[model samples]
Target: MGGVTFTAGGSGEITGATFSSGQTNATVSSATVSFTGAIFHNAVMDSLVVSGNSSLTARNCTFTSNGRRGLYVETIYPQGLVTDCHFRDNQEYPIWIKANCMDMLGAGLQFSGNHYQSIAVSCSAGTDIQRSQSWRGQPVALDLTVGSTSGLTVPAGVTLTVAGPVTALCRRFEVAGTLRVGTGNGYQAWLTGPADTRGSWEGIHVSSGGVLCLTDARLTYATTGVSANGATVTLTGSRIVNSLYDGLSTTSDCTVHLDRSYLRLNGRYGLNLLGRVTGRVQNTELAYNGSHPVYALAANVSCLGSGNLYPSNGRIPVGVSCALEPDLTESATWTAQSVAYDLTVNPYGTVLSIGAGCVLTLSPGTLVRGGGVDVHGCLEALGTAAQPVRFLPLGRQEPGSWEGLYFYPGSTALLRHCQVYYAKVGMAITSAGGYVANSQFRSCSGPGISCAGTANPTFYRCVISDNQGVGVYTRDSAAPNLGNLDSAPTHDDGYNILQNNGQYDFRNESSVSPRAQNNYWGTTDPAVVEARIWDGRDQAGLGRVWYLPLATSPAAAFAAPVTGLIMAGATALQAPGGNVEIRVHLLSPASVSLRVCNVAGRVVCSVPDRLTGGVGERLILWNARSDTGRRLPAGAYLLELTARSPDGPSTRRLVPLVLR
Candidate 1:
């Protein structure tokens, strides 16, 4: 069947031993061999006769050049799904949809991030077909190298893998869901808190892979041997000390990146990279590992080493050291060497290049300090289902032990299943996409989850109490403000739950609306409980106007969302349920008239003020009523709350009221 151009048939499986073609019009005789990749050199594939009737399979042969495409021969009926196959070279349009894709001058047919100019549609209805999915903007084509297809629409959740030198910072970071540092010792990662000596403190533990990061943190005495199932771990600008076992460890494969960090006073391996591991060490060093300064198995070691990892002999050569500074006083060179500036590198810096797949884990209970990790490029940390990432501060409930977790902007991930506190700020996000849920924040100078003018950043199912400052503050026009609610309440410094440190008036900005809305006061006081709607009876509203009588007892007296402001339709409309209080004052001597009218234009309550004097302001109060003293129905009603001065016209508002 050189170029026989076969016919279409069934939904059965047709096995083939040998099938090959290098020309066009080569139809798939039966479901025999799907032209997995390319049909042939100049192959003219199928022309879709029926729905699921056309299929050409290529079990074991290969096509190397321009030929018919998978979607070319078959029309887009059976959804053009090609699986468990390979395509080599042969080119076709990227996007080739058949249905409603018209303006496609190869348009909709070739939609992608690359051909976005002609394909990527805008957010407007002119092209906004899918509304539920909020597309950031135009799309770009990164998956173009493999397929010669004309176009492809960028769908949601399409993630791109990044390969790099462990320098680029990302927004998100996750480890197993558990405490680390003080609890799981020897992790090489340290924490800084009170009582630097020892305690029954909990250590860090996770079911699987863990990635540790830091930024402005200080760690102290933790358990021994920090470990990860099989995950990439990172430590930048940090410190680790007083550990008993291996610094960091992993089972499967991983890469350990150390930058501007230090390690001291360890009993076992200073830093251990198991399972074909690679350490990208930059401007960092390891010292005082009682046993092997650095441990590695010759079988699993593929290193592009720097001056770190110590000698292959297992110990730091007793001779080599950082150059010392001298002072010509009493015992000059004996001034004692202090490991200054977080880390003391030798003459220059250290750079380690790794191939790819490696699992470098942490020795349990490793104490780490100094500034935490700072990410800026392509990074992906995927822990196991049972094993979430754990970020534990060293020692007990000591303060200033960690710098908290920092998610550099643009990377899109903050952290999950981790504990951060006792440092400065729990989590600080500058400019990026952040999603931090199921996390904890303990005694820290919060401003918990601080975002400095970023895009929609979310903090969901997070426990943030016992901190010193505000909870979640958003400014600079952000959206999707989710999970600002209190799942559980913790206590600490001033502000209790959450504090809206921004200007939008937490009580108003629609971005954040918690089930149990936590106010910016950060405290869970009666005020927050009371003012769940808003506080105060006389608080000035948008018009800056205050209704007469302001508010009534317990009603206007209760607390509200700390919007730092209050608004109302009628002032005297106190805790208005059934009892309505209205005060009336006569104006121009014509008895001031008042009445609460329902939507049907029926006067539910009527109160006429007596002839009054004085040109100044007058107040009127009303006790919610009906013509027959019967409760009004629960529908729309206008509160004709009115007042009039002897010299002024009566003032009244058609305020809406409900019996809720």
Candidate 2:
């Protein structure tokens, strides 16, 4: 039969009919048209076209193998119902309609095997979606303003493209479920705009109590990928790329957790954070962006983690310029970046952890001008011998160019294998206590270490040298543990080295005497040692520096050479029951011992010592368990490996590990 056209003022009802091989299967420009139990196939044009404010009621209809769209509806005042219909194998989209007419689609609609397996929707003005809905097996293109109590779920293995020029608001869904992008199954659900151009649509805006959880999702081609205002977002195994603006922009009291994700090729920053945002980015990549990888100006946002890569970005360093407000309520870790980082921490309870191999510098007159890290909170600078953390001056290499680290009252610190250089005072401890091991405090204008106000800090195998002032100065009843005078195993063997000071090596201005034995103080002569010490022997009211039983020669250096052994392994175990394989290569026959220790330096698991008969590679597997076979809790740990050769060459390596 030829194509049928229903003109204006015409009413048509066709039931139980089949129309095939027509130029146009059916055209409705009339007042009302109803089709029930109908089959329309192999049309030369669109199988069914409804336009000009026509009301179309399609029920129990089957449209298959059409030349164009199975059903196309374009009406300003959309008044129609489509239910229990099957559309398959169409040349174009299975169904195409205007955004305003989306509500006419009812239950029991099946679509399969179309050229574009999606419902193409076009809208000039944005639409308000107020109901709980799930979009699956097809992509819906529209600009949506999801209502406050409404929920939108793009199920797994689905794609929902946000098109048009307006921003989509996913805001405050308090009653229904939160907006969820994709579930994980190696399926990356796509949330994109027009692929031909960037910034085709203003991206998703999540605001005010809205929650967006995206897993295995890819969002791209927008002005900004996801902007949050007082909302919560968690993205895992996701990618947000090719945006005209930032990949993720957070302003004002938001929490975002991003893990194992990529934020790349954005016009602006990968992550732009401004007010009071708090979250962590772990094992993620923020690379090849137009601006900084992470531009964080908020003091509360902790934009740092382990195993994260920042390669080929517009800016090199991770810029941070915020003061931890009244106090820091959460812990933060600063990892190594491509360039030196500028950091300032002030007034906090939580810990500020500096990762191994980080290079920190204080630029003159920039953030915290002329000042370094002034810590009222706890600080843990944990570095290994192979990759020691260094704190150096930016421009001027002379002493007093920048104020050094100051640990104030009620603060604590743990410094391991660290190097401090070109500061006014290398470290000032006032009424604070901590442990410093295998660290060097050098090239300071003032004393290498100034201890006052009843401070008790332990110095073990540390080097304090080349200072204009004294090596170690104590006042106001302060007592420092330089080394153990007696050969007792109960106390730490503090082989501290002090040398090349303009003033005395050890100055005692306090009334309390401190032990300075078992330490190498530049010379082995007792007379020279006494002359370089200012103690009770020189001052009438000051305490004495006990310098007896001094080391005859210099102790072992702070960092041992990496000679005979090389080891490499994964840094993180991402889930429960996960194991990490460590590869060890030896230069000669050696005895190897491996141990797993917690962040507190307590050995929890120890692998049996093995003897390598020849120079070769060996593999060791750690099952994320304790020595007693109990599963380990998820946290940061250290893998310590020691290899000792028969010819007296030895090497040790410390690798950071995270079990999640």
Candidate 3:
């Protein structure tokens, strides 16, 4: 409706001007021109082209049904910056660029962070389809056919399989370049092949080094889903449902990373990795998929040292690291067999619960056990230091255990000076509880020490190495973090020594606080003391530890008002000894003399049963000595319960000691 044309110059601002398409090109002879709202409806022209020597900044502009490109540029050139722009609903390509329009696009050109929409485009001829193109060079043109054959396309370098039954085909289908399929525009941008002869795209083809990243991209392959020949395909936060063949297939050592993704109602197999194919998966969910959720096999001859796959609580056996991020409600049971060698846990809190005779082992300082550790829902480890706990299988340990640590919920444990290894998840945090000082979980399934929705625990002088998930994770409140108390080493040498781990270990609040002065600490730093090592190990020798049993049982007073003994549930037993001597007395004596015996069961003590009466303050001096005047072993030992009742002598309470 205007008769005159208003032109601005030199770093000009379009104050309150509205530009409508009529008879020309919008030229910014100046270095910069800010447009508030410019509706360009091409009534005749083929393209609404914008040329600028420096920058053409447009904020809230709509270009509908333009003959050609909604906004075309000869070249953004160098030193260009574009932020918060929307390009949509155009006849052809909504936006196009030349060269590395985004990358080192042109010298000083930088794409800090840009969002793109259904901009069906191509950098080069065979760019997306993987006809051998470079990522840093110029942009490829969009013309996907087949092979280096059909020209360039998208979804290159990967494979797929449909789980359910359906039919479709795409003779000209490919995914190339780095496009995040989700962005709420995936459905609008992606191509869904037309109905076919009731058979899905049977085969998959991908070029080398090409990646297909799908974020929130919907794929309904009817008969077959997707297959990756030898491309790095990533399915992130996306979905693939109702397919005849499996959800995915891979070959030629390609990699597939699935994050927070899901695949349901598949046909044959949910997911399969054939011959030497490897993958890394995290936070993904799979349900009702064909026969198995996941099927993976390393090179034929040997299925050992295969690729690594970690799942933070998915469908078990069908996937790797199932118990990883267990939800009390959705936790599943896991098992492992004699894997030839010792199974190792790279992270602490990895779930490893095995049956009897099945040994899970740690090579050395490199072992770790995560959360859930008991099949019965209790946490138990039957290993000691001098012998170091082993989880997988080796010597007396190589036959490998059929079980791994279990993490049920409402469970807790305090383990140290031991190595846990070789299982599904090193230590699965099945229940709610934790540990302290000198414990190590390395080379296991995930984050070594996982924090499932059901558990919250702590660690001291503990080392969680080479795990699958985050070193330490507290995802949502359902997966609440009890608390994280990294108290400074308190022991004389900086290691925490407490049945309670000497420091509160639940990770609550999300923030952490410093520890104090005393004995061993779970999350305490040694630097606070002059005796700390970088590996989170303590330099001090077993530092002093004095535990007291608060349980209401006769043995609770065995160390009679117990002093200098590591306290168990209701018994005051033994701990890593320092220079301190452990003394104890018989609160009540049986019929015979009770002796302190070693593994050999040879009597080490002779506490006569002739005078005591349960918890009755009977004095029985030990002085940390054996019967023949020799020092005892450093670990834990049972206080032999020989009986000499007033009625007669007895041996009944030997197998299971009876407290007074």
Candidate 4:
């Protein structure tokens, strides 16, 4: 029983190793048992049981026809070497070993015709598997920790049941196999835990430098379905559902790619990205979660892909925040697939381009305490009239709810057909120049546009209205080109609408005068205009804004009959190359200005102001071209004609035209 070697002669057998009913045939307790060339057959109970502090070395042993398992390990930390052993016709498993004692299983052990051919592995304490191993056709019970430099692969066509957690520390754990507990059917492979309720077991964890790639896998009913901590994780065509926490979580410096996957019924966010994690998520559906589908509020965590669906979550918006790295050299485009984004551009040569119809929300505590787009690099946000870009506040629709776009010195931006709403200042340009056309800056807490430090941006056909502060504020020698009085008709010809501002319409706090001639300032009265402007007339130190020739009315003002002029014209143009003729019947002498505007109310072409000599019909021709001689696309346009009589009264007409 203790330190005993039981051996049979060559080609001989050791038979009738019998014991009482419901007892082991032989128990090695606190002893070393060596069996060589021995055959144990026809046992009434288990052939061998290794107990506390006991070790078994079995070589060339044949154990068959036993009523129970051929070999059973019951010690807390069993030690054994099983080699060249043949086991068959056993009532139970050929060999049963605890998960912690799995390392003692050596090669050359054969089994057949057993009730349970697969070994049963149960471990109370976690075990570190140090070697590369493949698991199949086995019922694993308990936690498994794969050591670094090791790999664990669950082979295909096998369902590996994990009653406890599975973790890989600096190693790889791939699930080409299936793991499931219940009878649900959908995915080809399921890695499931015994969670009648959520968080019944801790989920898979891939620690730093570890890689966990799940292909066509389904995971459910765990604390957190999968956690990638500074690891590389890829889940393709997988589903993670019914987790107690986030379905998938990636911590700092993790690279994760989730493609064509589904994450639903999670207790929290479907995918939680923390700190500077970078990857792409494409063609994935994250819905029915307890919280936001994707929570990526950490800085520089941009999952830059498209075709993702987020629906029926606690929050509809997929919150995102990113600070472009200074070393990023490639231009990036933000699409509308991810609902909103809070971004900051470093002073690099990269251009952050926003696609058409994208909405950027400025919320506090995303990139900075005062939420806004702080750009020290270039930003290109061009939108079409039908699908214009929008910048809005996150929570409340109140002014000063968030800071507005701030273009720092040496930064450049191109904002066209954009609507900026409810910000502290709609746009602030400091010693920078950019073109802003066909955009609206409305309902802002401060000035609609603030230009300082020699900023020379062109505001063309823009509307700055209903601001709490001045409509346009210029200081420190800033000379924004509102409009030129005597300049030839060009695309930059300003027809901006500056009205209904709480303070002055145009405030010049700089010593350098800026020409703001062809703009509408609510009324044409010089006294009214002077009263609404804060310039040298109000303060001697500020330069006087020249307001000699004002627009008679708003550029897009519809038909209002004057006493004199009657307008008729071709309603449509056959082609972009073709011309449209307008017949203006002037009952009395008048000065006429014609402008061709796009569907977005942006003036595309302008005819110089000309005086009518007599009261006959005057013909004006437009060639369907922009001011820069570029052929306009075939679309709907408006022909706006304003006629000013010799007296101060003016009349306007809007003619809709369509070009084929």
Candidate 5:
């Protein structure tokens, strides 16, 4: 017969084929190839490929120096019987088998010198390797990314040593078994990668929609023990220690829940949160980390209870407050002290109130959480410029964490050089007037300062920026005076800097326009300031904001400088077609524009023109064409622009252009 078929008792020897040209040395398909004692060695492709409905029975076969894979037995029907085979020195997996194959292995199957002789596939009927068998493959580039449809479970007491990085790419990777990295009889799972502070390799990365649940397991010693970007990762009774960077890091709104876990001895922060991520650390031990145990930059981490030790190793970090056992609620005069917990002011009624003349001085880095400071008395929180009292939420410091400092009708608050951020409203005053100087209101979900119901607070030298809503909102005859209300109140003390607010810098809902002069709007142009201030100019049935003699630069304002290109007049433009003359004082290159916008803040016409030359004059002519290429009818329009010098810190003039 052409096919080599040996009886059960018969034996054969096939060897001495030492050629490697990326081709298979031996193949058996759709035929009965039986070798009782075969010896195949030195092949480029797999040493033996058994596929289709082939019946292969090889006893005591020795396969060495296979290039790609040692033995590729594929398909569900084909079966091979290897009693005592020896596989060594393969490039990829030594024994490669596809899914759903009826492969049988007898006792004493030895894998002496191969690189990662492991089987990777999912089984619906389940496969079990007894505790007697072991993996004797050499540890080379054996990085494995598991992608099985069904779950892959390793039974108890079988410690699989992963020499290289092991990632799970399936939808769900459950580990009810144990996975070891280093050879030790310790309780922790040891990873054998280089322990440099920077990083070593790509540790374990879980993709989106992937879930990694580790119950009673451990992973240690990699660049990052576990990194999940927008994945659900939960660890119960597990440990991830001895990592270079963070022991576990999550970003992009990933939900990470850790219960009864230990993340100890990491190089950097034990748990790092980036972006808008949110997680919970319940009864977890985070110890001996270089930086803060929990470092969150614009992220949220909710400490569940008191069992979590924050500074289990080093001192408390500069900004992070220690996790308090229970949320603290106080109302008396709070003096200088380190607030290392979630603190609420006046949680119960006026029982623990801050009475009159009781100065409550908060130390620097005092993080007072929500519950709000309901001041029926007096509060004096005068922090320095470098270190300010930070009011935050229990978990994350995002906007709307808590109610802001509320002042009753007779209460008073003197805040100097303080920061009120991440609150529902930065400060709410009702009929009780106070002094707020050199303070900052940032990142508030509501208005920076809501002055209503006969509240008259004076804000001096304040900088309000990056608020989710308006910077200073007033309603119902609530007039909050800005800048120095001294002898030169109308001339502007020239200090407050408000810019880049979500809505308007000054939103006057009252019937009268408030005086907010001399404050810098991040630009020297009046048109930019008028566009940012939401008053009667933009909305009908509302009061306008009186912002004149605006600051040309930060913290300083001068009378309109007679330099660069200056608009002569904008009111009486020659109907339909006219020349808008601009006078040039200093010789400098400038970008000039005669923009005509309606009351609805829409750009109707723009005369693109530039001015360059000595201190003389320049002219811009407009044909009254709207942005949609149509001739605009003369009704009412806002002509505003800075016909002046190049954009810099220098003072520039904004001439009003009210085309009738």
Candidate 6:
């Protein structure tokens, strides 16, 4: 059967055989031949081809040529598929196909030894041919339509013009090049088909083993921009618009990933996920679709990421569940769940309450706005440093636009690296406990943190600034624990920084003076602290805000510093006209101040005020003049030197000075 020619309709399988040195190795008219592990060596073979409506599929086959065409499909409506086949030493084209016939060339088809073109197809319909391997496009215009091919890849800076409807039957499609409507705007590649619903041309059909990936590509004016059937589709920095049907349709267990892409003005849904298809839409924009921006069969289909635009004209899909908390208008209990979208608490006495032991996790960059979050349960909004959770006002972004979070008596919250702004009170705690670490509260009408009724939330590395009212307000029975004050070594070395508030940073409204210690004030002056605080000094009836042992700088707000002081030469120090030299050794940069007292712990004079020094040792010269600027008689005066650093509290040393 080396030179056998089948003129009748039949189907057979050939394997592990060789046919060579023949005028025409094999010819098929109406027959179907499926061969594997077969070799055809042509000594002078004119045609080892399939013709006359025949079908041939050969895998792992070799076709060695001797100055002749390797394989040809020249008959009407013929179909041939060759995969992993070697065609070497062919003087002319290794594979030739008539325009009417179909040839599905799969991967591993090599034609390295072909003298002429490896593949030649007659351009009858002027349609694009389906390709099996990856294609690199030139900077010139390419008018092609893919048909029944495995996949197509167009590189950057290339312009691919779709001459007609591009159909990929069970194939992958990808384009990094510019693809747009080539008819009206010749710069764009578009699918050519009937504008009506009876459009016949299949528009980019991707099926099993096919993945449609597009990056920075513009695809527009198609019957259907993309259709994914049991396939995977990914579009990054791409745009798909002006489709007759859906912009992107995924069905039959398909998966779609869209990142920083745009889908606009499609006839139907911008993205349709049906039949158990899953999708991840991130940093993408979907707008101006005839239907909803995203339409899914069910809620468990797609997950939303940060930075997506849902147009006002588009409606949320009917059956699909949003990535936000359940839309509730009234006071309702929220359970443990993940919120993947922006959540807004409706007005009219509506409160988003979390049930006890329930953990409501907000995704990074998700906003929880409108009305206060009533925490009857635990709130876990632990975001990273890059992407933090934002609690903002849904309507007006001004101060007091909306009420803030309300922690109930038995509830708690763990807000790490979160931001709450544009609210009446950033967080109001009553008889609750939680940890607020690395959080920011800004532009609030009331206190950033208001604690009452035994609310003792520990704040670590928090920043409360620029509020219209007090930064931290502690009422009756409120004891909000600030930075750790343990003398031993500890990792709890972070503290809250309160500054630039319209009112006092700390407002103690209770009968007892609350110790708001180890916090950085905007200024190091004690007078400024007393003026800014609304404590017992401001009002007689209210409690005092004891801010003694205050932090000098932002760095000192967390950990305390260490310093040492000593007399330069002798223990006795002369005052008045005598110069007293004191050596100060510091581990960090600090502001030094020296005080002289009359052994009664009463500061008689501030000898040296505002003496600055960096790390290491420095000698400070004191003229020993009293606050009254007069010479003192011979007496024992207490000389106290205090140094303040940013890392922690100040170090003070007392030495007796004798004035002669």
Residue-pair clashes per candidate, as listed?
A: 134, 0, 135, 1, 1, 8
Which candidate has the top score in lDDT? 2
lDDT of 5 at 404: 77
lDDT by residue (369-409, candidate 3, tens digit) is 22234532223332334434444422233211323455444
> What tens digits encode model 5's per-residue C-alpha lDDT throughout 1-660?
112233433333443323233467666666666665565655666777766666677777777777777677754464556677777777766766543331354445666667665444333324322231222223222222323434333344433333222222122222323433322223333232333333544455654545555555566665777777766677777777777788888767577788888888888878775534545667788888776676643114332333566655443432222233111222222322232423331233211234332334454444555546665544556565665666655557898887778776545566656778887888888756666666788888888888776666666677788789898888877777675334332322536788877868878887666767778888988998888887777768767776777777775211122122232211123333443333222224455555677768887776665444433233455656687777676566656555444564222332334444
Q: lDDT for each of the candidates?
A: 0.36, 0.68, 0.38, 0.64, 0.56, 0.61
Kindly provide the TM-score of model 3 when superposed on the true structure, using C-alpha atoms.
0.32
Q: In candidate 6, where is summed lDDT lowest over 10 consecutive residues? A: 562-571
Sort every candidate by lDDT, greatest first.
2, 4, 6, 5, 3, 1
Model 6 clashing residue pairs (backbone) = 128-145, 180-188, 180-189, 180-190, 181-188, 556-646, 556-647, 560-648
Residue 55 of candidate 6: its Cα lDDT?
Answer: 83
CA-only RMSD, every prediction: 27.7, 12.7, 23.1, 15.9, 21.7, 19.8
Cα lDDT of model 4 by residue, 1-660, tens digit: 112222322122233233323345566766766667766666677777776777677787877877887877766555557777788888977776554355566666777888865555443333323233333222222222222323334334433343212221112243334323222223544555543578765677766666666666677777888877777778777888998999988776788898988999999989888755667888999999997788764332347466888879886666554434332222344455545543321222112222211222221111222256655544455555655677777677888776888776645556666788888999998876666767889999999999999787777778999999889999999988887656543444667888999878899998988888778888988889888989988888889898768888887511211122222111222323477655454545677788888988899999867446455445566777799998789888877777767775555655556766
Give the poorly placed runs of model 2, Cα more than 4 Å off: 1-127, 137-177, 183-188, 193-198, 276-280, 297-303, 331-341, 344-371, 386-389, 393-401, 484-493, 535-540, 557-660
| Residue 147 lDDT, candidate 5, scale 0-100 | 30
How many clashing pairs does model 5 include? 1
Number of the top-ranking candidate, with TM-score as the measure:
2
Estimate, for each residue in 279-311, the C-alpha lDDT of model 1 and write its tens digit. Answer: 565555667666555444322222313344332
- Model 4 gets an lDDT of 0.64
TM-score of 2: 0.63
- Ranked by TM-score from best down, the candidates are 2, 4, 6, 5, 3, 1
What local lDDT does model 1 show for residue 275? 50
| Stretches of model 6 off by over 4 angstroms after superposition | 1-193, 196-219, 222-239, 243-255, 259-396, 402-419, 430-432, 437-439, 452-454, 474-478, 484-515, 520-546, 552-660
